[model samples]
Target: MAAASGTRPEHMAPAEVFYDGTEAKKYTSSSRIIDVQAQMAHRCIELMALPPGHRCFILDIGCGSGLSGEALSSAGHAWVGTDISADMLTVGLARGTPGDTLLSDMGQGLPFRTGSFDGAISVSAVQWLCYATQKSHQPYRRIRAFFASLYRCLKRGARAALQIYPENAAHLEMLSAAAAKAGFRGGLVVDFPNSTKAKKYYLCLVAGSGERDDSAAAATSAAGAAAGAAADSSSSSASDGDLKHSDAAMEATDGMGSAMTSSGLVVAMGRRSSSDFEKRRRSRAQDRVGAHAPARKEWVLRKKEQRRAKGLPTRSDSKYTGRRRPDRIT
Candidate 1:
């Protein structure tokens, strides 16, 4: 199916109504979309701070057709997925996936017992809960219920990464505020904050502790320092290693600014600052300096070249091409 133009249905209806039979099938089968969801799920789990050990049970909320759960399964982690659409779950079950699947509306709350999973992940799911299509459905009340239930479902100190696509800053605030009211002590982590297509926001939540947020920042700083140290070490090595090491260091610093670490801290992501925009404006200004004003003769020649390229009639370039002709001598 072709993507919708101008307007998105996701912004309007409840997920269950929007993701019916063919829509669910098409969503599950689209390779491009599948890859995107997989990448997002990987990032979401990574932000969860799950330990690197034996397989741990994870919750995949709004796991449309088990796409996100597939990512968890590939990583050797066991997952139980829940979605509002029976059609989506049907598609997931048809795949013979390893993870258990549930048919449930996230706004109503998850069905699991308290401390049921090691960690939880939801990709492109939570924000849907922000809309209320029916009078019976209250956005704030529903979000609070889901977050509180999710908070109780995870083991203490276990983080939940909810990848959300808020329509605007207000929607984001609504979701975050609901989570906070539900006793979740973490904040939103935005990846690639300056880019439009590549940006992602994960609502990282800690079940019982407030210090996880600080710990996340500390972890990011430490990772950056380690990367910096390695670059310095590589500088002392062979000349060829310096370039590679410096690149690695720069990448580490970039990642540090991107999001949280794996099982480390629950740091909130920062937005692009005014200074960043100023730097970009300065670079753009520098690039355009002397670009607008061209030598009169050179300007005529360049315009002539452009016209010729377009196969348009062009005046022959001459010193007098753009100047008034001198008065004819008597």
Candidate 2:
């Protein structure tokens, strides 16, 4: 719709299919999405460098309910949101083209021409990307290609920033490597607070000059070397302290971006589970981070799952790990 897609539904839309009714999806009433948008907008205000009424061309890669668009408008900028889901786009369009909302996937290669936007911001998107050049959900390779496209799409110095939540070093490593190949300059990967109780996350970002994208390249190279160093440093230390310490090297990011079709915008009641909390785990471990305060919810969920599996009291009485076998996520 609106010059994004001709008629077919590509995979770049941001609205999830199961939640189109919009009663109880995670991001429907979930305020965390807004929290991140607020933070993203703050960054955009500085990064875009646009004056009032400048009519800056903007793209919200995975624009869900148009939260990013709302934030951008508040900052005095025009916006164009494109997603794959008709339902989600419906939600986005309801806000009326505060700018221009379209339906297109970043993976399919941004439908817009080169230098079409002054800035691009992707919030909790990108990390969920899996489509690769070979097809069949090659998430990592697709991520790399997406970045490379960004480099060609923007002008020399346009700002292309993304915030990802990496589950561990592996996540960050993949992003670092791809961003470099994709042609980003320097990016700041920082530390943040997280807790098992509340499920807090950290942001790993790749931000800098689109002109040279040196920082992104450096990040990729450094990450490669670091991976080598970590592997060489201690292949023998399997102890708890060593293994835990291994994760210490993983940092949060402040920026990142990409595209996807819409899915999961609205949902039937009772479809969400506590596990949804960790859906972005890999991405978080790779980018976005929030307050890290220990909470007991994780342990509680673990106990509930155990109890449910054993056909015991639905209520758990002790601390546990929310870990679920991959087969059980559905």
Candidate 3:
């Protein structure tokens, strides 16, 4: 299929057609794919931030060959994996992947009852919904239906971390918008954003509002305790002024950084100080003034000095430096 044509499998053929018995075997046998999938699965679990030591019933959507499902099992969770490819499921079964495997298409929707799962995760799968290989397949509608079904299957406040490799900005926006329309709250989280190949995207969605509030409260309390411990340690190691300066710098740089608690709840931590805000406001005002201000002797000299320091071509300062020329007689 796609492998034979040297094109991306998603673009070459439908997932079911692309991941046939040969591809399923090849995928499961590859050490690199296995490692990457495992790493991604663990990261997804970390992003889920489920309660420590608590066993969860997780749904693995598009769980090709049960690679991600294996991760769930290792993490002491019971998972039910659903995939569009029967060959992949068969291979997973042969490989003895932990938990159940079902032959199903996620685009058609998850075949589970309401609140059937504690949480959900998908790896390199959700992006498939953005493509329409078949004539009847409407990408937007399929995405909406899949997300709505996912929303209904998750318990209130439960989260789903769907790892996707979107084709472009439009695909990413469409997937996120569809999730939002399906009543899932939250946003996309990108990891290793600067790295092209290493970068990954996860749509971190919450099923409902109540669990979100509870998770936030829990994260806040946990963050407070952690902050207190950190402060105590810093106080012991550094002077009070140094500690305050460091804290202020952190607040300025990490304005409202997210903290994920044990309960899979992400909460915003840290706040921009009033002093920081005032500084930024003053800097902006200075920029505005500088934009229109007439060049003064000091400003011109300062710019020349900066250019000179940077090893750029700069004329030597002379008696006429920054001096205004006499207006030409009209």
Candidate 4:
């Protein structure tokens, strides 16, 4: 069946693949959000000062391809990531990074038991929830639900860092209000000295000791259904629908019965930081590559040696590790 006039955004659909698209691809190579990583490491180091078992349990929501996970793992923090796109997850899984990765939708209530996470972080992913709404779709609530679900899964006394885009007063107000209502405290931090786009935003929210909001779920469900319906069909000519639908279908090379028209994301990290978050992030970005990963290379070489010894194919097109050697990243 044809997709309705407004389904997924332009950068959505096989949304997982966008992780490799130009913007994120650049961010990946250059580490544009490297500062975010440093901040995360600094906060984690501070948390480390706490007695054992006190360090935060991190959740990287929409943690596309484990970019954030790799950073957290490198710094020695326990983290788990979840996203709706398995294709993205596949890349992450292949990397064999530390921590577990789950496939789940951010717009849905997370799979964790209540308050299971110590803190949560999201990067370059929330904007998908805020895509322009059609007449009948309440895209705002999807954005709201995205935050609400994060609030529900994180423990009290924990923090959340969310970065959102198209920086404007209106969006800031929307984020602040929704977070407070969902039981998080600690005001907004706007870090843009240049322009809205360059403006780094941080919502360093501390979950309240108060009770969770009961009404968000029903409203969220209604909104998800609304998003599922795509935009209103009555207003746009049936004529346009055919053309738009045809275009969307033609663009969907990855299947999953969806496509994106346009997309953007702002990444943010949340955790317990007395104040060292920024410093830690800066230090982390500058971390030296250990002169050598001899142990790591030895392990890989041994595996290949073992395969060769056993007369098994040492190289193959398959992505499985034991099945074939790897294409190393830095």
**Best-performing candidate as measured by lDDT:** 3
Score every model by TM-score: 0.66, 0.51, 0.66, 0.51
lDDT by residue (tens digit), candidate 2, 223-313: 3343234433432321111111123222222122211101211111112466776776755664433233133455567667888999886
Report lDDT per candidate: 0.69, 0.49, 0.72, 0.51
- Tell me the lDDT of model 4 at 144: 68
Error of 3 at 165 (Å): 0.1
lDDT of 3 by residue, 170-239 (tens): 6777887788889877665554332234445567777887545467344434533443344334422121
lDDT of 1 at 321: 67
Q: Could you tell me how far off, in angstroms, the CA of residue 69 lies in candidate 2 after the best superposition?
A: 1.0
Tens-digit per-residue lDDT, 1-330, candidate 1: 233433345544567877788878888887767777887788777777666776989999988789899899999999999998898899888988789988898888899999889889998778777688788988889988998899889887778888776665666677777777777766666554333344455687777764345565454345334433443454322112111012222232234333434332334433357898999998779656533334645777888999999999987776566453567999
Pick out the ten consecutive residues of candidate 2 with the lowest summed lDDT. 259-268
Decide which is better by TM-score, 2 or 3.
3
Candidate 3 ranges with C-alpha deviation above 4 Å = 1-6, 216-330
TM-score of 1: 0.66
